[model samples]
Target: MKEVKKMAQKCFPLNDVDYLAEDLRLFHAGRTVGVMQVTGNDFHTVAGAGMQTIVGKGVAYLLTQIDGLGGVVYANTDNVVFNHDVADALFNRYDAIIIRYDKETNACALKLIKGTPSSEPTKYIPKRSETEYELVIKYVYIVAGVGTITNSDIKDAILNEELCGIAVDTLAKIPTKQYDDQMKSWISNSQADFKKWFDDIKNQLTEDAAGNLQNQINSLNNKVNDLKDIFVVMEEDSYIPPEERKIGRLYFNTTDRVESGFNNEIRVSPNMGLKKV
Candidate 1:
């Protein structure tokens, strides 16, 4: 008689032995939580700071992107609009603009977290916790005598996937040997296959809207070129460690969204992303 080894919950051709809920939760738990550009609408859309209102595109902040979701109840995303006053000379200080998710209230909204006044003169960012997952979008520095906030006054605070050890496409490129057929199809398809997939999804949608979104990809104008335009940043300057840089991995840099010269065999890019049935 020979001894046999048992497999994990996510084995392919999942059946009675596999707990689908547990598998999904485990999958979602393995990734970092942050705002992700899911619908090809906006990646980091945000603008404004004044007595008037600021504008930002709707955001998706959940494991549903880089990680699998345990379950989805209902999530309706929309653009963000905020109003803040830049302190005029008298009360110059640092502040943080954040998107906060409160588990207790089941609410996700934008908030301005105030920082200590005149403390070493640095940008302000809010604290994050298990219950209150705050994604800091921008750090603001209110200058004395200036009531206006400019690009120079704002700094990006979006969670960096590199720093978090969770690339945006990490889940997309997981070992397909263990994933179900759909996951394998998503991960293993080439651009030509991807174009067909894109066309299929588009066909299911209303022609006018589908045409627009499909055109958005076909034209390669609106959406970020996640698959095609290889990020050209030098690997030496990347924050990723040398050992972590592996072939067949897609790398993203805020400045340069390029692959780190790793994958020469096969280029795997995330899907163009499909919405409701």
Candidate 2:
């Protein structure tokens, strides 16, 4: 006798097949959610199925994985794991993940998820979130009579609080005495070189050499002026006492001279203001 053949069970019933297909298409198209606005530490939207849960848990996960240079993180629906080596590959592989930021925004945005590339619906777009981008602070000190000071030369000046235009918080972040000796040695050498250049200019020995010396002097002078422009002393009216100040605050102190007691006392002032709370 022939045995009866068994039919395999279908994943979905005939009526539900269309709905499942549509949902699958939506997932494949990456139409999971709209633009996610990250304002500070909070996620704006708590609606949608997977999105709501991801927003609540994944945001914190994204923040932790952010590197100093900044980048996007990816995860499966169930697990949010950020591995730098695999972020790009996983980002492309996953369908329902959010993107943190891109190079255009200076890696500032909180939610940079891939979607259908449509304008976010008015109802879904949250109020603009205030996000803070990580900044790389650099200190450039300009000396008037002396040539441009090296980063090493400015270390002591920075630590002593002699450099005015720099924010106090920025100053606090610097490694104290990291460049003190190096900067001092550089200043000594630079002064000696300046004297030699000055003598060459005054002697008027060879036109070409003198011209070159003069050009060097001119370049130095321009750098000094540029430094002056950058380090504008905070006006007395805007001064916030140190005790009450926050990070990224820009204030000027008239008393703090750039190269104090030097023949060319270039007064360093704070400018561009600070980014504080």
Candidate 3:
């Protein structure tokens, strides 16, 4: 199921025109978050920044000019007196400024100040926010008729799109069937090589097994004979039946006491001699 995003929240209000210049000073040269049209009859609108537009005519045209100028516009309403502090605020906060157009005077002027300009990328995060280009359209409509969304709203929209695209692109990079096929081919070749090595080892072991057993048995027999002195030797004269001399059986005694019954015992003989059944 698709999840619904929370409703948009604004970090700053865009409706208040009084702080527009101050906000621009801080955020500077970005798209307008919201649009405010000075509608009071007392407002004697005059151009304050980069370019000018007639105060009462239409906001769309003014926004277009601001877009072209690539800055925020601060036009005074007829009701308010122009404050130098406002001008200073705009200069500090925004890159370019437009004064309200006076149709009667036919004058729209731009204010210029000296400072190092900000990098374009920093000025507007192209992927994260609306470009100066897009804001013009959004602002003009907001100024003229349709109310515009806040700057925070616009930023949220951009962020949402960016996140979605990143997810999709990352998903696309996952390994596919083609990669699995290549891996399988490698594994098959490795298994074949391993099987050949195992077979060669088995053959070698089979060929050596008989010789290995014979060598081991001979070594054990030698070890038993080395300890023959410890056994009792019976002379022919001591034989119970006065047997003639030929060979004497050497007997060994064991003092081992078994607490458990023996399951089995192994008997060995010299090479070529038969083993006890």
Identify the leading candidate in terms of TM-score. 1
* Tens-place lDDT digits, model 3, residues 124-190: 2111122222221111101112122222211111112212111112223455568999999999999
lDDT of each: 0.51, 0.34, 0.33
lDDT of 1: 0.51
What's the TM for model 3? 0.22
TM-score, per-candidate, Cα-based: 0.42, 0.16, 0.22
Q: Is candidate 1 or candidate 2 better by TM-score?
A: 1
lDDT of 1 by residue, 1-277 (tens): 3433454534534454444433544544534455454554333434464532353564444432222343112223555555556565555676677665566686766777765556355554444455554556666676667756666666555655421212243466565456687776677677668889888877778667767778878767533564433332334465564466545445454333335576544333443221111
Model 2 residue 233 CA deviation in Å: 1.1
Candidate 1 accuracy as TM-score: 0.42
Residue 114's C-alpha lDDT in candidate 2?
24
What are the runs in model 2 whose C-alpha is more than 4 Å off? Answer: 1-204, 238-277
